[model samples]
Target: MHSPTLASIPPEVLTDNILLRLPLRDLIAISACDKYLAILCNSDALWQRKLRLDYDFTVPRDRPLENVSLKTVYQRIGSPRLFVWKCEHITHPVPSHRDFCELKVDRRVVSLVATHSAFYALDDEGKLYAWGEKVHWRRLLTYKFPFGSEVLPVHIKLPTPIRAISCGSIWITAIDTFSHVWFIPDWKQAYRIVNPMLEQLSSEAQVAQVESGWRFIAILTRSGELHVVQPRSGIPNPGQNLELNGSIIWNTPLRLATMPPLPNLPAINVGEEEALSPKLVKIAASEATIIGLTDQGHVLQLSIPVAVGESILFEALECGKIQWEYLPFLSEVEKVRTDPMYSPPETEFEKMDPWTQHVTRFSRVFGRCPPPPYGFLQMPPRIVPTPPCILKISEIFISDNDICAYSTGPSSTILIGSTGMRASDRAEVFPAHQNRPVAHFARTEHTAAFLTPQGKIMGWERTARGKYADEPSMMTIPDSTKGWLFLSITAAGCHFSGLAIEWEELDADTTNAYESASEDEGDD
Candidate 1:
């Protein structure tokens, strides 16, 4: 009899004991040598394990969609690109593409958030990884974690997996899979909030979302209630010395309280009747304000009345003085139906107020160029009727003075406004993105990025010490991408994070094998 060969081994034993132990790169190399091995290597069970191990992703209870396979999902999230500006003061060449903190995460980054000097990423396994100034400064100056220099990302320790995470200027807030809230005052360890109200709230209702702004955190419950929490350690205390940085000397414990209902509610018109009140479904925050979205599409703005460099007073919060204000917006109908024409006024000073006339005269004398023959005649403002166009706001994003409102649809209508913009105030509509719809967008203190449907990223940024770019420009994908297509983009501080999948066009044979694996397996 011929000597027994490796091919005589049972396929199950070969896959489980031998092939599963090989690294992904090595496995793919070996699979190309034999057609039989290739079929076995592309098995659903094999790729499923690869997805879980390499990307920390698990398929939902729902079956895979037709023509798509687990292997495709695994390949799509494998490419994670990061670009950072080593010299934030320079603007010549774009920020160079580099490994995240010079170390590869390997796992897929599902959520990423940034503070001014730090970036926090949450992998699919709920593991929190942090890198940037916080990690480097602590290790070098304070010798906090001597080994952290090589580690790059300091994997935070927690009791349970974090389902979601948000970062403020100094604090990182997280909601665990169990619906418990955790605060990471420092980057290394996480401590769960032990307030009686929070404990009771968790048991009564699930946490729908958590958002962090500056040093304050807001928790939204599924029941539509909102709770604000300010950690004493991170917030500036007014009672302390005024000259200090304000956040370092606080000694009071964490202050947690419920937000008062909106004092000024906007009515949403139904078919024939108008609903006076609607429940808040989402929220976004900046340093001094919180923007809330109602289920009926009305936008509410709440100004957290805290002095510059001072913390919120808990007593005033309970008193209900801080309330949500109704924010009016231009509706799509008004944008299309009405046209505001700007023409030379009847007279040079027709619509010009006293202050405007003074400014125009001042500009002519001290201006770089001579003023127009008519000087600057202000355009007459058009008055929108009572009950201003209340837009159906589907979502909102806030970063400092910039606020972005997105309407419902795959191709959303985006309106860019500021924190305190009024109904009559004109909002910016991006002319560059008019033809290409945006799929994702994120903003840090100085940077804004938008991702298109076709794996393209475009944005503008103000360097830490440089001026903001006048127009958005397309970002160059790193050569390392090879055949990967970016699917998501996010920014924190001066750096950006992107997640990509392998393009199907890169390997037609592999793509076909993935889709026909079931049929091939049955034939064997």
Candidate 2:
């Protein structure tokens, strides 16, 4: 007898054993083979299995996904996942046809963040995935992982489900569901929990968010508390001290001091201590400053001073090895006594005013030079306070040295900080024509992109002088992405990657076949 044709075999058998195992590309290609095969291949069960196997995604159990076929689910949650486009600089001799290449993430990503050197994604399962330049991956893995050399995206093992993640130039901070914060300083050190200051606040109140600066960390808790950790000194010079060269020491996380009341806000009533506490709702940080958003929608700013000239003293104090009060008493008495007639005559301690002598002793103890002689020239330390912006900002983005703020009420975008010496200069608000309510925003060193609620992306390029284009223009979405929903966009290493989703619609023939198959199954 002639062997039964493969197509004649029961559809159920082919779907369960064969089509369910096919990869996404192969399935899409074979769907055009025949009506019977197309219908079977698009079955909810077969696509669902493919999704689970390939991307580890599950249709929400609580949602009515039964009416949707697995093919539709795959299109919505799988095929349009990650789209990457390389900039002309990164991809020299650009491709003849400029287009975005799909990066198969192989998972359902819910959130993503990227830096110039690294890209990170958090999947629906709360697992962290990282991919980027091999050099960076190596530096980030250093002595921590045996497989630190991997350049492709790989699942990072963590102690718990990640709720939020933030990355700086080289370090990463992950907040788990339990509100515990884990920090990865670099590739050489193993991940460790933040100090008890963070741990205690996290336990008492849920950590609403976490953010990272080049050398600082900021955390915002549900209780309206803002905590920041920063370095006590500027970048270390290895030539001066090998032990401290390249070493990064973070200060203990400390609650930010209460902010002064907003100009128009009413004064607090007597006996209302809680009113003094700023109810911080969100926070963002730059290399040396932290910006906070209050419940009343005011923006507050604070700077973390990096000790420059007398860093050794600052380091000693930061490490708790020296106390400020003790330094005054420990000043060198012999030096003043021995140098009595060197230049200006030195006054005996008993003859000097107590307060003036105390100040002089304190300065000497901390290694700070006394005021230069009246005629001598001296440069004063540059100390510019970050003036708090009165605008009601809904989101803030800090890239390199530029600060951008988006206001929801006015639907406007403002660029703060000038390119030159005046970084805290007045902000330049974009023209009203370019203003729109931004739903998502991302930036790299020289480019910033914003996604509007209407599903449009607008981008601004920084000029050579460090100013953004006066007006932003709409970004071109690839033709292939016509029907997809853009979720988020991020830039890293001269490339912009966008997360998108597409929904598949059932054709007339496929829909009829599906209905007929349902009837046959009921009859059986």
Candidate 3:
């Protein structure tokens, strides 16, 4: 009975029971002190379990690249911090600055989608957390009301691990790992969307992505097929007179649940003689239209059935009257390929802030293989290049009538375009963001937020009379935590949320000095 000394405990118990259960900070501390504990803590199995538990990082079956370890992967992700802010409204109370409230989560956030009533964040391991007005809904008398004004984030359990989610005004559409489509009419429950076409299509090709607008849902398959449908079952109709945030009437009766592919997509030239249909890799939806991006760097738009007081007519759309239309560039892409003065823009790897660099490295190490914000490439194929800049649509953002195209080329500007595709072939570039290359962009109906490569946020919000401000304003965090860097931003209606990481003041100063010296060298 030697008083059960610390060294007497079995190695298995220490590794499985004690070490695995310890917090990261405590584990790191113990690992630094003991050589045996350090070896156990740095094991691939241990770190992979930790990553899956905290960040939803699924370890691939293939061995990682040389010199990469699970311990390094864990360190690269860092800890995620969430911040929220918005102008005050009568029903939803929010702070104008991000300092007054802190949103705590156990794991790292993978994506964020919001509606006017609530905010939802999906963590790395497929755990969904929700906050805001609609987290807890109660029916008092004839009308349903939210339980609280500003609810804190809470874990939401589902039948399976969800990979992607899109939000409507009051509902959410999600795709799980099994390739099954789920519609959440209420935040508390989810129903599997039962359709023969979806079942057949899913069997043939997996559902890679999903997007939801005010009334329509867009499904993109792994084989590059796009389908649009209006969800009718499991949807609680709020009646004809009760208006929701994004309530609108369809031009046809609500009987259209069929998934019809976009007819006659234009083919692109891959070589001198070979041509093929542009494989749609990304899609964005608004109230009245759906925007599509092909793997070849073409942007196409199609109008959906939206009306003031009529129902949607499926028969009208089936007659081949409405089809996808290409949004043409001002000059032919072939011309830029032959220009003598054109030089490719240098990659901005050196200009990225420390937090961005960490994310990029982590993505590469884990074989994630996609740029931040979304899985789109930094540059599209060369066939769709723009003049002088040699730009292609790297990302697209849309809400209501405002849509913007983000390009990655010599002049990486966030080019704003309207939903009206026929208005002009030339996109109206944002004056405030002409020179600033953004790493992320988030837009609501009245607000536009841009995150620079240096982790600074610039926003252009609607004025008092409902027009955009001429000059963009710097979005600042609290003075006490001035050195924090933002990783992502999202907005819906009027509310905004950001994910950031803390950096010490001294380390931040040193990093800024390094960045300044690098910029001077580039200038020289």
Candidate 4:
């Protein structure tokens, strides 16, 4: 008897047992075999198994499995997503594309963050991986660490799974599932827990979020408290002048004493200052600034004052003396209104000086002395405009000197200080796509990417003169990859990187065989 072909096998058996065991790449190839086989290959059960095996995706119990499509689940959970770095080594190496040959990592990455010389990734299993310059890699590895070279990625497994990760110019911060925070300073040999206070606080109340600045780390606890930490090299003494090595050594987590109270929240205790005691819902940090969002949706900003010619390294050691300032635009407006310089000119001649009254009467008769032609009276002092008010911010991303904030309601993006333009004038600088909301936004030292609601990637880069070229252009994948669904995109230094999933289509021979097999099975 002739051997039964794949098309002649029962669809239920092939789908339930045989096809589910094949790899994702083979399943893609098999989907082209025919109409009926294509349907079986694309079934929910098959894709669900593929997702669990390939990507370690676990469907949430709260979701209704019957109503959700397998394709949707795959895109949302199974697809690989990562942050790509566009550094000099990755974008423009001396030998041209040589870095691509060295850019090989064995694990599947879920998220990544990179600086100028180093790149770090968190795998699906929450393991940390590092690869970059030899000096940087050696700094992160312990004396007994196995890796001897930085050319290959090295895996570092922590005691617990990492929940969040952030990178600064030369530092890294990660939070574990148990809410413990770890810090890695520039040129450090190993990561360390933030402090005993943070450890105790984390155990009591989980750390909801963590952010890194150029020289500082901001931690927000679930109890609504905000704490800031800075790395110091030597023991912190009262009056000793210490030199810094540009490496951070977090000593203790300090509760910021200047956090403003949220609107409609209960007043703080009798001795506790309102500014020091509001529960923060979210927090974000830039080079020297921190922005906090209260549960009541109030936006609060605090920044470290940098003196002229002061280095960030020195400031890192002096974090204890830094004071947080509240950014109240309304109060600033009131102060400006009360200033004597902004007061309207006096109309009553009785209050004017004798010389001013004489000059005014002469001007009233002689067509107003053409205002002093020169000197002090030539022009009034220029009035400084109020800072732009940013309300209802959904998310914010900061890189180098650029700050990008996404607002709700209209779903518009706000770019600040990226192009050296005033914040008020920058409202129209970023490109606008009608009705398409941005799902993700990221930036490097020079370029930025925006992922839209329709799964399209839009990107823009700074020109040689350091100005944003008109608007963003559509980003496309490589020609070699066909029928791939683009998931996320990021830009760094000079190159663009993205994550995508492959999709397959049915072919003619498979379609004919599937039809013939169906007809024959019906006759039997």
In order of appearance, the predictions have TM-scores of: 0.62, 0.55, 0.60, 0.55
lDDT of each: 0.58, 0.54, 0.59, 0.52
The window of 10 residues in a row where model 3 has the poorest summed lDDT is 136-145
**Candidate 2, superposed: residue stretches over 4 Å from native:** 1-75, 78-80, 87-100, 134-151, 187-190, 230-256, 265-278, 308-391, 418-424, 462-482, 503-524
Q: Which candidate gets the maximum TM-score versus the true structure?
A: 1
lDDT of candidate 1 over 167-199, digit per residue (tens): 765567788877878766776445566566677
The C-alpha stretches of model 1 lying farther than 4 A from their native spots are 1-71, 78-103, 135-151, 233-277, 308-312, 330-391, 408-411, 420-436, 444-447, 461-472, 504-524
Instruction: Give one digit per residue, the lDDT tens place, for model 2 in 1-524.
Output: 88887598887788778787655456655787888778777777687667666555544332223234556555456344665654432222233224345555777786777666556788866788876632443454232211113246766776567767887765778787678766655533224345667767667757888887655567777877665555323333334533322333233535354445453332323445336554677766666556666554455555544552344433543554431111100112222122222233234653454345655787879877465455533322222222222334456656665554554322444344322213223444333212445666666666666655544556766655454444567655444545545656776545566776764456898656755654554456
Alpha-carbon deviation at 292 in model 2, angstroms: 1.6
Residue 6 of model 4, lDDT score: 81
Ranking by lDDT: 3, 1, 2, 4
Residues 15-38, model 3: lDDT tens digits: 667877876556666777877777
Clashes of 1: 1
Clashing pairs in 3: 55-124, 56-124, 56-125, 250-311, 251-311, 251-312, 252-311, 252-312, 252-313, 253-312
Q: Is candidate 2 or candidate 3 better by TM-score?
A: 3
lDDT of 3 at 382: 20
Candidate 1 residue 92 C-alpha distance from true site, Å: 8.3
